[model samples]
Target: MSPLDDEAWEAWSPHELGQRLREATLPWYVAGGWALDIWHGKQTREHEDLEFVVIRNDADHFRAILHELEFFTVKDGTTEYLPPAANLPSDVWQLWGGDMRHGCWRVDMMMEPGTPDLWIYKRDRAIQMARSDAVRVSETGIPYLAPINVMLFKAKHCRKKDQIDFNFLRPRLSLEEKEQLTTWLNELHPGHEWIKKLPIS
Candidate 1:
């Protein structure tokens, strides 16, 4: 059961959320479909919610700044309020945030494993990259996941929107990004339909 009751919450734009966390020192980056939109330099579709990813080690730091909002730890489709400085269980990596004052859902906070300088793919620790290479910042200073990395994550789901995202970004992928994505997809999801669809030659 979710700790927070269902309520209407206003979805915040990436810029608005970025401004709210402008003072944060810990690493956080826009993720999900929004990241793809950022890479495209335009909003291709409406987003139901905003997602931001923070290193697991910095979850507490992230909670500290967003203390005013209500947070719930999600596991196996159940949710419980996340108390101050609560240590998230090993299997759990998602947090849902809602505005208490307005009774509305706000953000989906995703936790990932990595050090301050590296990003280790949770599914396969062997897959890693320097944090600098894993993220990019918009001209306005909003940090977002690099496109190929976002596509890699989306490949796991391959929903309609995910396919749209891939179709939109495929032509824009650099040679290196295309090669890396193809290699990772082949290793992680052998025979994924996108493998044949990707424009990599």
Candidate 2:
């Protein structure tokens, strides 16, 4: 059962939900494709699920809120394979699930791995996703994925659906963003050709 009602789901926008997330979990920022859409100023296309990157220690706090929202809790403190698939990679990942006012919504949680570049000192490695400027859901008024991170995360996927998302978002990227992303990619993967090899939707 969901804490929200039909009208509640109808009333909550993505931005409002973002506000809730901010309220519930301080310092856990939204990430992935949705974050990218916020950066780009629009929703480039449809997305299957909402993705977030939270601090590793906050998983328990996030899980508690998910329980309050009536979302199914699968993993308590670790990452693993899940039954359903979304836009993310198949490798082990941690997730929480729930039905909002609408129906089912999945939250993909990636506790920042100790990648050399993910540290706080590596400010250049992160892009700011302003919640104030994110695209709002018509029904719920919550903010969702920003566009640049959407493309970056999709670029990592290199799948047909991801290719489709990229096609929708690529033309909208600013020249400076494109150049910076290209540089970031080259630095992140060193020689990965998936971005170059994938077919645009």
Best by TM-score: 1
Total backbone clashes of candidate 2, pairs 3 or more residues apart or in separate chains: 24
Regions of model 1 farther than 4 Å from truth: 5-9
List of clashing residue pairs for candidate 1: 9-104
What TM-score goes with each of the models? 0.93, 0.54
Q: On residues 1-201, what C-alpha lDDT tens digit does candidate 1 reach at each position?
A: 236554455768899889889999999999999998988899999887888999987888888888878788878878788776667777779988878777777888999999879988877889999999999999999999999898888999899989888998888888888889999999999999988876666
Model 2, TM vs. native? 0.54
C-alpha lDDT values of all predictions: 0.86, 0.49
lDDT, candidate 2, 20-51, per-residue tens: 57557334555655565555567766656666
